[model samples]
Target: MEQAFGLVHHGTATVGGRSGITANTICCDVCIVGAGPAGLAAALRLADLGRDICVVAPLPGDGNRRWESLTPGAWKILDALGLGTALAQSHCLLSHAASVSWGDREVNRDGHAEVTFLIDRARFDACLMDAARRRGVRLLTPAVASRPQKIGDAWLLPVTTDQTTVSLCAAHVIDASGRKALTGSRRHRLSPATLALCARWRGPPAPPGVTRIEATAESWCWSASLADGAHYAAVFVDPRSLRAARDEPATAFLAAVGRSSPRWDGTLASPVTACDASASRIARAPGLEDTIAAGEAALSLDPLSSQGIQRALVDGQQSAIVVNTLIVHPERRRIAVAFHAERQAEASRRDSAMCHGLYREQATTYQSPFWSRYCGQDTPVEHQLRSPVPLDNLLPETRLRLSPRARLEDTAVIDGDLIALAPALVHPELDRPVAFLAGRSIGSLLARAFSGASAASLFDGWRADSLPEGTALELLRWFWQRGLLVDSSATDAS
Candidate 1:
């Protein structure tokens, strides 16, 4: 390895099978911070392009496990990079519709949709790192990087480890450090809108279809059987809710779940062995400079979107394309701008629609006094109807107008009084509920309920009555009327 890089080791020590010397510094074309999905993906892409790439991440034995979502496209990228086998063996596929219920009625009014995968984040990340190593990407573990400094035409990075402090220089630096850490100008720091609480369980395999059920007062919670033979469930709640539960105990949280949705009964009864949680949201101003951000660093998606992993994979691929293009043709910076703009527009549309629905639901439930005050029935429809603002617009001042109870920081929302308004404004696109039943006809509304009643008990009260073929078509028509799904028949004919 030293010979390939034309380096001489000073001592009789070996590292990653290479006899190394005393030098602690290194240099490469690209220095990627954070070894999570985004960083690993970037390194692999650069390596494939034959560029020298160096990746720094917290060491494997460092005992800090990162959390991540693994989508279908992300899995495909891993397969292309020769890590698919490892991922397939270590992650869980979520193959069912998710919903929320106040009583017997489903909050999301839709029927059924596509599913995503839930992964054992630590194992999955390790697989990606290993794949990068096999492809000649230099790997540095147990390292923490300070804010990157721009020096002349290159980037200077200082990293600290147990042994010593090391400095490396690179042409460009990619910030994939996620939300906990970031580099570049602090122009666009937005407070987080919500806090999430997650936990894992060991139980019987989840039913064929995995569903995530969320309530208004309680945070978004999900459960799925993992590929590694374990069950997992997590809740994303308001910080106030977490605080309230902190003193009460597990039963209080579980009781909150029971009030929101019937699905929690099974999980509440199961023995929970592990709990993991965090708060997340997009950067408000993402600043201006030659540097670009991707994944959580670029924009944090609501976990309810279930598109977290999909967005990361897409961002990684698109960012690589943008970087390579800029390297070869410095004049076409517009290409990168256009790329980011298109994505921004798409994300804006989705965020606005989802937040609107969530807010409306909260208003209806009157889950807590906090929610009731901000989402009071008398709140103006215009405020509720306001276009889903880009995360940038959801700043402290803006959020205050939406909800008077929130506390905002430069980068995180320390208090979540305002986020209560999020449920009121959640978009209809996101709130629509879906279910999958294996039958041919729409039977009696009650009978349909019985066909799949057993499973319905697992989720909210979803019944599996058969629908007449024509009725099924009408249901699709209703969904189209509501703007949930597109009618592509015309486009297909064209």
Candidate 2:
């Protein structure tokens, strides 16, 4: 066996079956649906933890030719997955800047601050799938898996390939099958339904190393050059806007692209692909008794955040941990499920809030239906949005207390490679259950601060509690910014 990227090569994948509950059934510790980023990431992590992982993948070359710009942060996660050399070999294009024209402002960002890469999503996903296979994951390629049915303690998934159909019986299932998911029902719509019209171009060249994003009156458009020298442009708009030109999707795509950036017109290399770009989440808890939904199967965010792949990769790792806990420590199964559910909800809320805020800002500059729809009052935020109290307003003699809308709760959190219960500070403005910040426990910090103590007294107490020099003031600012801490006087006045 050859070793590549720290993975043991099992030569080539064969179309055979592994013995499961029955002789003909394929059995494993975990059955992962979809071979995209999330599923593959989970497969690799689960395999690392000494679990048998079976990944159901589409046939080779069966992915969309979408182009995505990977931030430096996203690249770090991919690199950790042993894709550094693979991506370089795939000729991923590195860019040093981006051009944005939005909200009455046009700015060019230089890569001196941070660099990014434009990658073909199809090739990127293939690289991840290959990496997972090399790491000893059993892959059912050229296969489609149906929704899993519970049988006894295992979930049985029916997989169909070109040759035959087989049953994959596993102790747990991780669903990462993208929008048309194989598992998990009851989805909650986060943003208004929107569609993306995308196509590849080969005629004209864009800036050598720049990605252009421009906002139009009724839609937003972006274009970037791929590693293979082809240019890609996409326009996102309301689905209803395209009903009139239903038969001419390509024409509507070109027209929409021209409205924002007219210079991007070029010879089409592929037909216009219209995909749902709306933000949504699985309303039901992602982790159930023996199944979990990772990546887009759990929560899909608006493309405006440019975090689709990043979130998928992160969820993969988290889901693996939750699954491991459910199987290894069955007594904590509920905690693991609730932890993953809360995390997904937190992600949905944070991403939706950011997207809505941006749309509202853009709507102020361009009065269009596209922007107006997101500015409405369908936000998922827990409580009414309130401005943060200024930290400078807190005097040394001023007393402080927790915000009325926030509280400390015993939350399930990730400890090492398992889910554990811990004290977390929860607030409507917060993205997740925050248990620690700046190496200090949130519960202890709050306990010392909420004792009717003055600002100076809190600071002195925190320092006495072994917080570093100037750490007390920084912690105070952090709380004030998140609206986790408020003035006692203000509460009394109200």
Candidate 3:
């Protein structure tokens, strides 16, 4: 039998019910919820690892008609998943740079630096789902999976499809459900809460792969020509700011685009859609270690970053590796879970910080309440608003241990130029935290040793076997907060 969706499938089931793929009550190695890129890519990856996979999702994904731009980095991840070349050959618009208008400055960013593609999310997701189905992954659609319940070391998910219910039992479950995690995950919006009002347009022939971004006194706007030959424009605004626009969402969004740039003038059209564009993350919780949340289900990136889709593709692959490894080496389950958590958290923090930094650059010129809020400044009425990064989450007395899941490498640091230690889980964005650790070189020591050594002991060791000082402890706390270090006592490895 051919693997569905062009996936490289292994031979058929050698174990009864293990490789089972059907609609009725089924048993499988893994059951994945959500069939977007992350979830579908994961299903393909896990199937390659020889795991029987079942995916439940609504096809077409709301026709996700808004134009989505894909970066070169995102393609690398898809290439590894066998979708990159297919996507490249599919209906897509290719461009090299974006027109960015921030504050009073407008320029073409990274002109000729990278190949970016503008795609329709619906077609993109459909392509991925088709790939997963061909790869031996059982496709269950129009089926809504209820919250998974852990039963006797397996997950029992009740899937409802076409007025029929199927009980699926799998050893592992992956929640790729966007924003509100389907596996009962909780999300806290990190950035100033904002909504995106979007509309599809047909006029003057949309630019080929060129994405336009403009920042105004009240909010920001983005416009791009999708592969479908439709131009899409979206306006992002704080609810209060959108209210100040004094009109309905579609009207306000059109008004925002009207003055956003010369290219977007009078080109707005109908079939508008709006969604929450706020940066959010799954809260650090106990049972989170039991399952993995990939893509938006784990952490939602900032639109201003221009790397959200890239991050999701990479995240989807990384999550699959972690899950596959854990299933093979059950003994390293703790380390694998820690790896997923820390990397996801680090990514979330960096995305938030980067967006704040970008906003700060524009705040100098605009200084409106909306821009001011993003810059960590507050109006009289918005007194509690502050920078998105909550660095105080880590406590001094917390008992931390080297995460067995961290990747070790010799990397440059801000403090000492270069150091041999495990760098921040997310590079470039959270490198400073590791640079601070390089000042003490604690990461180097931890790399050489650490069989679950306590953070306090590590600090004492940093202090030459004497009482721990506050500076090293503070730096280590950054690692703990970012997932490089895990709580020694909280994790019940036994």
* Among all candidates shown, the one with the greatest TM-score: 2
Global CA lDDT computed for model 2: 0.78
> How do the residues 311-427 of candidate 3 rate in per-residue lDDT, one tens digit apiece?
777677667777786677677666566666766776776667667767888999888888887767331121222233244644445566555556545442222111123453333
Tens-digit lDDT string for candidate 2 (47-138): 98999998888666432488887777778887887778877865578888788898988888876637788877877888887787788898
TM-score of each: 0.61, 0.82, 0.71
The superposed Cα distance between candidate 1 and the true structure at residue 379, in angstroms, equals: 15
* Each model's lDDT: 0.52, 0.78, 0.68
- In the range 32-111, model 1's lDDT, one tens digit per residue, is 88887778887888788878888778655432233445566766776776776767666455565444553235644233
Task: Point out where model 3 deviates above 4 Å.
Answer: 1-24, 59-64, 109-111, 203-206, 226-229, 243-246, 284-289, 377-494
Distance (Å) between predicted and true CA of 74, model 3? 0.5
Could you tell me which 10 consecutive residues in candidate 1 have the lowest summed lDDT? 413-422
